[model samples]
Target: MGPLPLNYRRPEYVSEEDSRQEENSADFYDKVDASLQSGPSGTSTGIPDALTFDKIINGGTCPPCTVRDFMNYLIYIEHAAENLQFHLWYRDYVKRFDAAPASEIALSPEWTQTMEEDTIAKIQKDAADKAKKVSPIAREIFRGTDFEKAPEIRVESRDPFSTPPRSSSGDSVSLSGSQATTYVSQEGDAFFAAGVKQPFTIQPFRSEINRVIATYIVDDSPRQLNLSAREQKAVVRALSYTTHPSALRTLSQNIENTLRRQAHPNFIRWTICNGNPARVTFARGLGVGTILVAMTGSIILTLSKAGRGWRALFAILWVIGIATLITAAKGMCVVLHGLHHRHVRPWELFIDDNATGIEQLCEGKRSFDSFDSCNSYEDEPWVVRYQRRFYVRKVFDRQVWIQEPVLRQIQDTIFLQSMLLALLGGGTLTAIFLAVPAGNFF
Candidate 1:
C-alpha cells in the first residue's frame, strides 16, 4: 500500500477536456473581433482605414502610425451633429409666418383726414410759437435777405428798333432804388429792410439763397405765380441789359445785324453774349495782350540804353513791366511774385455793364411780380429755378463769373505798373553793358 498506485492517487490528466476548452476560447475571441469590424450591417465594416478619418476631417489622409487621426474623427462627428441640429431649427423657423401688415396698408379716407388735421394743427401751433419767439429785430433781419428787397435800379429791354424813352437826365430811364445793403454781426449778417414786399432785399448769403429762391418760385399763393413764356423772356432780356450794360450795345448790334439778315426773332435773342464762348475768348485776349506789352517794352528799353549799369536796370524794369501788364490784364499781378518772394500788386478794374447783364440773363427764371411762368420740363421746383440756374451757370460758366472780380482787383493796383516800369529801366542799363565791347571784359 506504500506507493500503491502512484498513478491512481495522482489526479487524472484530462487532455480531451483541456483541448475542447482551449478551442472554445479561441472561437469567442474571433467572434468579438468580427463584431467590432462589422457595424450593424451584416457586411464587413472595414472600420474606415484609420487614415480615412483624417482625410475627411482635415482634407487629407492621416499619415500611417499617427494616433491623432482617431481623435480628429471624433471631433468631426461632434461638429456634424451640431450642424444637423441647426439645420432642423432653421427649417422650422422659415416654414412659419407671424407678422402684422404695415401701417401704410391702413391708409383710408378717415385715417388720412385725421392725419391731415393733426399735421395742420401741429404746424400752426409751431408757427405761432416761432413767431412769438422771434424778435422784431430778427424779423427785420430775415426780411432783408431777398436780393430784390429793393426795387430795380435800372431796367432795359431787348428791342433795338425802338429807342428807350429818355429820363429827366436824357439817359435811358433808370429805376430808382438803392443797392442791397449788407449787415455784419457775430451771429450772422442779414440784408433787408423791415416790412419790405416779397422778394425783399438782403445781402445774398450762401446758405439762404437757394431756399429763398425756391420758396418764391414754388408758392402759388395767388400773390406769386409764374409769368407767361413771352413775358418771362421779355423780363429776362430786360434784366440782362440792366445787369450787363457793356454787353448791351454788343447785344443790340447783334440783334440789328440778325434782323437785317432776316433771322428769326428767337434766334436774334438767343445770340445774347454768345454764352460761355465769348468770355473764354476775352480771357485769352487779355493774357496775350499782357505778354506782348511786356516783350515790346523790354525790347525798346534794351535798345535805348548803353553800359552795364543801364542794362541791368533795364532788365529789372522789363521783368517788372511784364508782371504789371499781366496783373493789369488779368488781375493776377503776382504771377512771378511767388518765385521771387515779391508781393502781388492789387488788381485793376474792368468796367463792363455787359458782365452784369449776362449774369442776370443766364440766371434762369425768377418769380417776378408773383406771376412768372415756370419751365415745367425743368426738374427744379419753381422757387428754386433761378437759384439752381445761378449755381449751374457759375460752376460751368466760371470764366464769365470770374471776370468782374479779376477786373476790379487789377484796377486798384496802379503802383504795380510803376514798379514794372522801374524794372524795365534797370534792364535798359544791362543791355548797354552787353552791347559795349569794352564793358564786357569787367
Candidate 2:
C-alpha cells in the first residue's frame, strides 16, 4: 500500500450518492474547510500562499519553523495531533529497522515452538551468566552510566523545563533538565557497549512493534490514530509477517500526507495569528498612558510663560511617548526587541486543565489526559532556561519566553518603524513650537 487514492473514501462513510459519483467526495472529518482555514470569523489570519505546507513543516532560513513547531501547533491549537506523532515515531522506527542485521530481521516460521522457546531460554541464561561474571562494584559503575541508555517513554508534565528524574544511586542526575530517566537492563547495556550484540533475533524488534500497535494502532489505544479499520488491520497483518519498517511504509505515507496537506497549512495560519512578537496588555496600556501624559504636559508648557528653549526640551518626552505608542500599535515592545525574545501566549501554554479553547475549534470534547499522549516536546533537548527567573507576577502571571528568529525580525522592523515615526512626529511638533512666539498662548 502507498498513498491513499486522491479521491479515496472510507467504505463505512461512503454514501450511496458518493458511490454513484465519478469522484468520491474527500473525507471531511478531521479537516478544516476553506472558510475555516485559519481562526475565528472576520479575523484576518493573513496566511500566505507562498508559505506552502513543506515550507511550514520543514521551515526555511527566515520563518524559523520546524516539524517540532508544527507539532506544537497541532497539540495546542489544532486537534488530531496523533497523525504527526505516529509519523515521527515511524520515521525513527524505520531508521532503526534499516540498521538491524538483515539476516535477523525476521524470525524463522519453520522453527518449531519448542525450538523457539529453547533458543530464547539459552539466550536468557547466557545473559544471566555474563551478568554474574562482572564484580558488584563494576556492575554498579556500569549501571551508573548515563550516556547510552535508550530514551524513556515521555511523561506528560505541563512544565517543559522540569528537572530529570533522579538516578537510582540517589544522586541528582542533572544531565539535562528536559531528559526523563529510563531504566534499561544493565546486562543488555553492558553487552551492547562491550561490542557484543544481543544474540536473540527478531524478538526485540517484534516486541517494539507490538508496543507500537498497542499504543497508536489499536482501536482503544491512548493515542489511537485516525486510520480506518481496513488500514489498521493491514498494518497489523504486515507486521505479523515481518517486523521490518517497510511494513509501516504505507501507513507512514498516508499520515505524512495528512500532516503535510492538512495539519501543516493549519499550523502556518496559527503561527500567523499567535507567533508574532508583541507587547502584552499591560505594556500596551502603559504606552497609551505615557502618550496621554505627554500630550497634557505639552499643552501645559505651551500655555505657561515658559521660554521657547524650555518648551523645545519637551521634544524628548514627545519622542519617547510617540515611539512607545507606535510600538504598541504594531504589537511590538521596544524592551523585548532589545532582549531578543517574545512571551509565549496563554493559549500556547494550554494552562487550563481541559485546554479550554481546543474544543471550540471542533465539535467534540477531548479528555485532558489524552491531550498529553502525543506531546511535541516529549524528547526535546535541554536548553538554558533564559526566562526561568524572569517574571512580572509569579502567581497570577507567568511569562514563558521563546527566542523565535522570524518574530525577532518582525520586532526589529517594528522598532525601526516606531523610531522613524517618533523622530518625524517629534521634529515637526518641535519646529512649530519654535516658530511660535513665546507667551503668545499665555
Candidate 3:
C-alpha cells in the first residue's frame, strides 16, 4: 500500500499555564510522541471489517447519511473490481494460450491476434483514465459496448476465494500463508440486477481503495470542496467494501484527516432535480395560471360590487391560486406526491414530508406516520433513514389521488372550501378598500 499523509488529531484544549508547563517538561513531550505513534482512541482507529454487505449499506452512524451516499460509496469498489476483473480475464484466458501452437487454440490465429490487441489497448486506456480518480467506465458505458454487460469475474488459484491450484502430485494446498480464505469467506448474499442474480461479491482491494481516497480526498480534491458529515459518512461506507479484512487500519487515519482538512463545497454545486419532466412542466404552467387568475379576481373586485357574496367568492379563489402556485414551484404535482408517482432525488431522504403536507392541504387531516402522531426518526439506523423514502411510496390507503391521479388531484371537497375561503378573503379586503376611498387617502 502507498504511504498515507500523516494524520494529526485535534488535541484537547489545555490552560495556558498548563501548556507552558508541558512545553517546559520532557515528560509531556514524551507523552505527546507516544500518543501520536499509537494513534487516537476508539474502534474507528482500527481496520473496519470489509466482508459485511449491511456494513457497506449503512454509511456510518450519522444523521443525513443515506442510501444515495451508499451508491456513491460503491463507485470506487466497482471500478477497482472492474479493472481487476478485466486483467484477470486476460491472464486466465488469452495469456494461458500464448505458448500453444496456433492449431491447438480454439480460435483462428487472426482472431486471437485481434483479441490480444483489443485487450491490451483497453488495459492501457483504463490505466490512463484512472489518473483523474473517477472511473472511466461511465464514459465507456454510453458508447454501448461489451462493458455495458456486468464485467466478467474469475478468481485466480492464488486468490483466497478460489480453490487452491493442484500440484504435480495432485494435492490441493488450500492453506496459503495468512490467506486461508475460501469463496465462503465472502459469506454474503449476492447483488441482483435486472432480475438476474450475480454471484461474484463486489469488493475492492485495500491498496486500490487507499489510492482512490488519496487521489480524490487528500491530494487532488478541488480546494473549494468542503467535506461535510454526510461526505465523511460516505467515506466510512466506502471503507466497508474493501476486500482486505482490516481495511480501516490501513485507511481510517488518512480518511479522517482528508475529510476534516478539505474545504467545503460551495452552496450551489452541480445538482439535478430528479422529477418527471412532463409533470414538472405541467405544475409550472398551472402555477402561472393560478397566479394570473388571482390577479384577475383582484382586478374584478376593483370594478364590481363590494357585496358580501362577491367578496366571499374571490377570497376562496385567491387561496386556491396561492396553494397551486406553491405546489407547482416545488416540482410536486400534489397529485403525484399523494399517489406515490414521483422521481426521488438523491437528496430526498424523506418522502413522508410530501404525504403529510398534501394530506393537510387536501383534507385538513393528519397521517398515521406524521411525526407528531407517531414515533419520530430521531436517531434510527441508516436503513431506517432509507425506510422513510420507501414509506413515501406506500399509497394504498391515501384518498387524495384516487385512481388516475393528476395535477387535478387536489380538486376535492377541501379544494372547493379553499376556493370559497380565497373569494371571501379577497372580497372582504376589496370592501374594506372601497369603504376608505383611495382619492381621500392620496
lDDT winner: 2
lDDT of 2 at 9: 15
Please give, for residues 1-442, the per-residue lDDT of candidate 1 as tens digits. Answer: 0111111111112232342353346474454344334243211221122212222233343221122222221122111121112222222322321121324212211213343345334434443453356466666877857631433323222222232232433222222112222211200111111111232122222123222222221122111112222222222232222222221223323232222222111111111112233233443454456445555544554456344343344454355544444443332323222222121110101113223766544432232112223213234233243344453343233222222221222222333443545456545644644565532222
Residue-level lDDT tens digits of model 3 in 116-156: 34533443444344333435667575457654544433312
Off by over 4 Å in 2: 1-84, 104-204, 226-247, 250-279, 298-332, 341-414, 421-442
All candidates: CA RMSD in angstroms? 43.7, 20.0, 23.6
Weakest lDDT window of 10 consecutive positions for candidate 3: 263-272
Candidate order, TM-score descending: 2, 3, 1
Among residues 3 or more apart in sequence or in different chains, the pairs in candidate 2 whose N, CA or C atoms overlap within 3 Å are none
Highest TM-score: give the candidate number. 2
Q: After superposition, how far is residue 317 of candidate 1 from its true place, in Å?
A: 5.1
- Return whichever of 1 and 2 wins on lDDT: 2
Worst 10 residues of 2 by lDDT: 170-179
Q: Which window of ten consecutive residues has the lowest lDDT sum in model 1?
A: 186-195
TM-score of each: 0.17, 0.41, 0.28
